[model samples]
Target: MEINFKGKRALVTGASKGIGRDLVIQLVKCGAEVVAVARSRELLENLKKEVPSIEIVPLDISDWKKTKEALNKQGPIDLLVNNAGLAILGPLTEVSEENVDELFSINVKSIINISQWMAKQLISRKAPGSIVNVSSQASMAGLENHSVYCATKGAVDAFTRAACTELGPHGIRINAVNPTVIMTAMGKIGWSDPKVAAPMMAKIPLKRFGEVHEVVDAILYLLSDKASMINGVCLPIDGGFTAT
Candidate 1:
């Protein structure tokens, strides 16, 4: 059966660019009323010009009080994609405490704070919806210089599982999508060198890093009722790389 969300309202964080931006576009096409959240007001304004009907909320998700305020003002939404994240890679021993705090604030804490507010909204309204957290393959395996990012994402997946258990009875499902070497604009720059990408690609059965749409598609599935029975799972969209 085909997936559809014609009248659903979706709140997508990190929506200014990359997979988040593309996801917003796709959701709009699928007829969902999208509330796009990100820190880039210019980019969001541009996106609004393209999709005039979309709602835009530009705020840093790292600030707990402000993030909570923004979400509370958003009224109600049917789905949430926690895609905002940051990575400051270096050797584990050399990583700064500041970096660790920053990464955790955005990549980890943001999800919990936002989801908590969403949970209250859902529970109060007695509504049912889905939440998709955009995690990374780094969460599953160790990568050089990615120590902090990995830890944060790992924590995110753990929270997804635990949150699913508590929120499931409330009819709010939560899951995480772990992608590998995606081909977003930022990704292209990070993986631009064949020397850098070749080795990572070799580990994947598909022999290629993933494209943004592949991830977008996976997230859309999990967000839709098509994945109604799928909850509390950390789905690896890694081109079978994790199979190795």
Candidate 2:
């Protein structure tokens, strides 16, 4: 089905690269006015070069005050993608406090702050809107060395459900997309070693990492009218890994 988002306004975080970048492109292609947020000014500029219609907002989501101010100025967002996250791979005991703080700040806290801002705007206007938080399959099941990462995503999954319940009456739908290992530049850099990739692949029923487009497609579905009845849901795109 052709999902048309003509005249809709979308704010996508972490839009500099990976699945977030593809989301911005696809949203723009569907005729939505997309405000792409990222910390990399040069990459944002390049993305704007490629898709001149996309509005580039270069700000770190971890800066809650700045993010709130920016969203207030933008006003009446139709869709919000809380896609900004950080991954620190290590045992919980081995992980530094700094890394743990960064993970929660970016992945968990930022989502709450941004969604609160967006929720207020939507509630005040009574506007119909949707929120898609990019979580992970790790949230569904724990791994050997992903305790901190799993904790952060577990927060995301919980937040999505609770937020949906609170925001649903205001005509806002909140949901999350939980993806397994995706083949992105960051993934390549982090899991390039077979030692890391081998055990991960073995758990997947499909025995392969998901592509960027697969996750983007899921995000677009949840944001569009097609998923009008779908809310407070965590849809897993995990290549059947979570099934077991």
Candidate 1 lDDT over residue span 1-244, tens digit each: 5677887899999999999999999999888999999999999999999999899999999999999888888878889999998989889899888998999999999999999988889999999999999999998998888989999999999999999999999999999999999999999999999999898999999999899999999999999998999999999999998878
Candidate 2: C-alpha lDDT: 0.93
| CA lDDT scores, all candidates in order | 0.93, 0.93
What's every prediction's RMSD, in angstroms?
Answer: 0.9, 1.1
lDDT at residue 60 of model 2 (Cα atoms): 87
List where candidate 1 sits over 4 angstroms from the true fold.
Answer: none
The 10-residue segment of model 1 with minimum total lDDT is: 1-10
Ten residues in a row with the worst lDDT in model 2? Answer: 68-77
lDDT of 1 at 66: 93
